[model samples]
Target: MDVTVNGQLTQVPFGLSVADLVRGRLPDPRSVAVAVNGAVVRAGDWERTQVGPGDAVEIVTARQGG
Candidate 1:
């Protein structure tokens, strides 16, 4: 299946969970926020959040600045 991540097109395996994606990209998946199809997904729910083809995923990480 194919999904868009941060506006880029990418192919992912079927039945891929949000947690799997995060773990693949970030060393600390807990430090970021995730949204799928414009709805925010809670951290605790990432493991259960399945992403399918044509879905849009936006992942943002926290940054400390002064």
Candidate 2:
């Protein structure tokens, strides 16, 4: 399936979950936020939330500085 991630087109396996995406990239999932198709998905639901084709996904990480 094809989905948009952070404004870029990307292909991912079918039935992919938000948790899988975060685990593949971020070393620490504790400080990350995810939204799908303009809706925010809670951390507890990441594993149950499945991403589909043409879905817009946005992932952000919290950082501390200045």
Candidate 3:
């Protein structure tokens, strides 16, 4: 299936959950926030949130500064 990740178009396997994507891409899942289709998804809900074609996904991670 095709979905947009951080404003970029990408293809991912079917039945891939938000948790799976975060865990696969980020070294620390606890430091990131996810939003799917304009809705902010809590960390606990990532396992239940599934990505589909044309879905908009935004992943933001915390960065150290100052």
Each prediction's whole-model lDDT (CA): 0.93, 0.94, 0.93
In model 1, which runs have C-alpha deviations exceeding 4 angstroms?
none
RMSD of each: 0.8, 0.7, 0.9
Q: Model 3 Cα displacement at 13 (Å)? A: 0.7
TM-score computed on alpha carbons, candidate 1:
0.94
Cα distance off (Å), candidate 1, residue 10: 0.7
Consecutive 10-residue window with the lowest summed lDDT within model 2? 21-30
For model 3, residues 3-64, the per-residue Cα lDDT tens digits are 99999999999999999989888978878999999999999999999999899999999889
Candidate 3, which segments miss by more than 4 Å at Cα?
Answer: none
Better TM-score candidate (1, 3): 1
Best candidate according to TM-score: 2
Could you tell me how far off, in angstroms, the CA of residue 32 lies in candidate 3 after the best superposition? 0.7
Tell me which of candidates 2 and 3 scores higher on TM-score: 2
